[model samples]
Target chain A: MRITCPICGERDRREFYYVGDAVALERPDADAPPEAWHGYIHLRDNPCGVTRDLWYHEQGCAAWLVVTRNTATHEVLGVALASDEKGEAR
Target chain B: MVELAPKSPLAGLVPVTVGRMTLTEVDLGRLTSVAPYRGRDEGLSEALKAAHGIAAPEPGRVTGRVAARASGRDEACAIWFGQRMFLLAGADPDPALAQYAALSDQSDGWACARIQGRGATQVLARLTPIDLRPAAFRRGHTARTELQHMAASITRLGEDDYLILVFRALAGTLVQDVRQAMQGVAARGGG
Candidate 1:
């Protein structure tokens, strides 16, 4: 698979280190209940359709990216820098 | 008293030639990694231009020269290394640059090599996954990618000349990998 890095353009998948689930970014507050922390740390939906995940361009630009892809078709729908996504989330 | 002499990583290795291609070690002089502070990209570019006569290069590109010899004023160049980072090679960086960016000395951290001549692209093709076609990766284009499982920075300096930089500790491996690729290409009568 090829990932198009915003800064470095397109690169092979081998250049990236996959970090499962973009939802990992939404960390629960330190004072949150045990169930919330447990869900954040161990539980996953593991959906079969469209999924968003994190990927680090370890051997390339070293940028964290959020890749929106379809698990069924393996088609990459979109990609954005994680920093940019956080800024927009705010 | 004992005198300490600076030795290159590839101290005893000589340049290798296969077919029409040659792989030679290069001394990039003082290497400095420049990372502009947040929202200071413009300031850093201006400071670099004023101090070194070159601006921060665009992503995947390089500005200035990569000289064959480290001597002379024309040896300095700014190569875009990764996101928001540039490698200032072949000359000493100006102290004034510090106000706009973080400068870290990397003079001895990397070993550089130049691969040139016909079929140079083929030699690299065997090692890297990036597209090396001249139309896609023109002169001054650079990429931080894997070179046969080793992290490497590759820059195209001329039509058939490329500059490769890898960790200093992997100098021998880099040479060995490139030599084997060179031989493979030559054996196929590609060069």
Candidate 2:
């Protein structure tokens, strides 16, 4: 698979560093249970559909990006910089 | 400088040594060997947190030292980041490799890059809000933040020091963006 970084241009899939889902999660309060902090920091739902995720071009300029992809196919639905709050990712 | 290996990927821009062999390049001279990089893709957040560190005898306004451990050439510079290794070299850098520094703010380490050369400063000035002046990001310090179109952290190794940070997803375009910015500087100079 291939993805293009707005700053670096076209590159192989290997160049990127995947961050997980971007759908906002709730934060646990300071006195919250220990499991809450662990879940928020280290857990993922691992859904298998169109999902919004965060990725970085670790090999390039290291831009933060929001990517839409299909987990089952490894096919990227769309890509955009995290800075782009409202652009069509595809 | 000694002769170069015929099959080096960076046969033109710089002559550096990787592992135990001196490689060739088109622009720079043949020099020492450098190492390859493997990015933090799987379990990155954890590794990143580990890499970020602090600086002791803080770098002044404009000072830095060359880190030439494994890489053969006079390229890579070893930055003092508390207890981390920050390598910077455009000659033949593999962005895929780990390039990070620990932060005082968060557990996650920030990714960074050392982009040097004459036009490097001017190139960054075009996309960032921070002053490129020596006073703003002097030699030994590192700053984590976002710029123009990306979320990144930058550091100053010297006058041209830049520890540009962005998500690994956008790593591919870093060189070109800076290149285009440099081109702008060149054009302005010509004009």
Candidate 3:
């Protein structure tokens, strides 16, 4: 897989590390019930179609990225900087 | 009182040469990293320009100062690491920028080396998975990438000249990897 970093341009996948689902960034309420906290920390949906994931360019650019990809085919649908709330990418 | 002499990270390793290429460590003076707080990048740039008489370059690019450093013939340069981040060598941090940015001294954290020769790009291509063609990765272009599993920053200074920076702890490993890659390029050229 190849990831085109917004700042560093295209680079090999080995330079990046998979950071799991992008949704994890939104933290659940701290005062919520025990079951709600458990679900937020340990449970995740296994989507088959398009999925949004977070990736860190550990060895390239050092920028966090949001990668939309197809689970079945492993095709990358899109990529964006995780810091960019507007979802802009080059 | 005791006096101490500064030693380069590669002080013990002999400079490597393969074909016409040479890899030698360069001791940089007053290296600093500047990072602006959120939404303060524009102000930081202006402050740097006003104080240092130069503007920071955009990401993936490098700009050189008009004056050369006392230790080297090459003009002093600043490399852009990423958004709101820059690495300046041969220049001191602007005290005026403290209001807009955070500054850190990086002179000892990184080890820099200059690579030059007829086949310098070929050897670099073998180590880094980047399209190093002259047209695509033109002069002044810079990138932070992985080399032999170690993080590195590469800046193209000229057609055959490049400045590579790696962590000080991994300097030996990086040089060793470059030596082996250069040998491969030389062997191919000789054959």
Candidate 4:
């Protein structure tokens, strides 16, 4: 699979490291209850269809990318820099 | 007291020529990595221009002369290394740049080699996954990618010339890998 890195353009999958979900960005506040923190840290939905995840461009631009892709077909829908996405999230 | 001497990473390695391609160690003097602080890109660019007469290059591009002269400080170049990072090579960086960017001396951390000749692309194609076709990667284009499992910075200096940089410790490995590819290209009559 090829990932289009926002800074480095399209690169082979070998250059990227798959970090688990984009949900990792939504961290619970420090004052949150243990259950809330536990769920945030341990629970993840393994959807078969379209999903948003994080990918690190380890060998290219070193940019963390939020990649939207289909797990069933392995089709990449879109890619954006995590920094840009975090700004939009705010 | 013990005397110390500086030796080049590829000191004992001679330039290799295979078919139309030649791989030679290039002396890229005073490599400095410059990373602009947040919201300081323009400020850094302006400072770089005033001091070195070169501007910070856009993503995947290079600015100024990539060639090195024996005169030491006559030529310099800025190669966009990665996201918001640039490598100033072939000249000493001016102190003024530090006001807008984080400057780190990288002269002893990396080794550079030049691949020049008619078949340079063909030889590189065997090692890297990046598309080296002139239409895709034009002159002044650069990429930080894997050169046969080793992290390297590859830049196009001309139509048939490329500059490859790797960690100083891996200089021997880089030459070996490139030489093998050159030999392969030559054997296939592609070079």
Candidate 5:
């Protein structure tokens, strides 16, 4: 899989460090119970198909990216940093 | 019998390889200095020692922070390899019998770290453009970079000597590419 970071130019698949799912669930109120926090932290959907997730160019310019890739094939579909994708719907 | 084909553009280049040592990658959240440590010999042993404690020998790779030394008499730019203390020096590098010097020529003498003190030639065949001639990078001098796939800071410690720190994530594939380059060079020889 390949990711094109704005700063580091285009890099092969290895340069990026993968995070879990990109569309993280919204946080509940700060006063919410521990279960809510645990659910956010631990409980994750182990989907096998395509998933939009977070990836970081750790070796390059340190850019946070929201990349659309197929989990089965790891074929990157698209990439955009969280800040860049902020407020835009996928 | 088929006549042996001559070496192509890849002849004389050494492929640099790495052992899968989990290095502490810099937090990509912000711009941080990734320099590791720099010293003569004693100082290097103290700061850039093996993180996992396995003798930190040659043919291995380590990625540490790089920054200017706070107080020292040597260099300002440096990277920490396994156990050796390397300071980026002037330009030039000794490559394998093949072509490896084409990787970099601009910022060539950047001595960041010494991942593998000895047996550096075994892995250098993976990537690099400098030729690993014994006289060129003989135990001290540095290698000049021509091109790199990752955002890397490479230093040639000696003849067939190399120390490099590429981003951690690409670690796996970079090895594969280097191996391929080596194969290409070897094949040109007769593979």
Candidate 6:
């Protein structure tokens, strides 16, 4: 798979590391119940359709990216800087 | 006090001239890394310019003075490494930048090498994923990318000249890899 880094442009997927869902960026409340915190940290949706995920461009621009992709087809729907998510919708 | 000559990271291996390509070790003096505080990029740039007389380059760009003589002590090449981060080489960077940016002394942390000649681009293309095509990676373009799985910063100084910087610890490996790659390119007649 090819991921387009917002800073370095398109590059081979081998250069990046898959960091799981983008939701990981949102942390659970510190005052939440243990079970709620556990679910936030340990449990994740293994959806087969389009989903937003996080990728670390470890070998490129070193930017964290939010990649919208289809899990079933392995096709990338869109990509944006994780920092830019609040400013733009894919 | 007894003194010893400085040995390059690729000591005894570089200054290699094979066919139309040469991989030479260059000592880029006083390397410094500057990363602005959050939302302070513009401020950092202005400060750098006001103090050093050199403006910070934009992302994926490099700015440096072209000096005819190597003794020009103030010549500094600042290559953008990422968002709000730049790698500054050549002479002492303004220490005042520390107020607005995180400054790190990188003088001994990196090894600088220059690839130049007829087939220099082809040799580099074999090792890095960055596009070496002239039209795309034009002169003065800088990119931080992976070179054979090692993080590297590359700057195009000219059509056939490139400045490559890698971690000092990996300098030996980098030189060996580039030499082997250059041999392959030469064997193929600049393939």
Candidate 2 per-residue C-alpha lDDT over B55-81 given as tens digits, one digit per residue, 9 for 90 to 100: 122211111233121223343332322
Please write out the lDDT profile of model 6 over residues B64-98, one tens digit for every residue.
65221122445676788876688777857777788
What DockQ does every candidate get? 0.90, 0.04, 0.73, 0.85, 0.05, 0.67
DockQ sort, best first: 1, 4, 3, 6, 5, 2
In model 2 chain B, the worst 10-residue window by lDDT is B54-63
Question: For model 5, how does the per-residue alpha-carbon lDDT over A1-90 read when each residue is reduced to its tens digit?
Answer: 457655434566666788777656355569999998888677877889878788876654456788877778877778776767755655
Residue pairs with colliding backbones in model 1 are none
- The candidate that wins on DockQ is 1
Better of 3 and 6 by DockQ: 3
Q: In model 1, what lDDT does residue B2 have?
A: 95
State the TM-score for model 3: 0.91
Q: Please tell me which predicted candidate would have the highest lDDT against the true structure.
A: 1
* DockQ of candidate model 4: 0.85
lDDT of candidate 4 over A24-45, digit per residue (tens): 7778889999998988889888
Regions of model 4 farther than 4 Å from truth = A87-90, B68-73
Off by over 4 Å in 3: A86-90, B65-76
Winner on TM-score (1 vs 2): 1
lDDT pick, better of 4 and 6: 4
Provide the clash count, candidate 5. Answer: 56
| Winner by DockQ between candidate 3 and candidate 2 | 3
Error of 4 at B68 (Å): 5.5
Clashing pairs in 6: none
Show how many residue pairs clash in every candidate, following the order shown.
Answer: 0, 46, 0, 0, 56, 0
lDDT of 1 by residue, B65-168 (tens): 75443324556798899889999987789999998899999999998888989989999999999999889899889999999989999999888789899999
lDDT of 1 by residue, A1-90 (tens): 899889888899999999998877788789999999999889897889899899999999889999999999999888899988863452
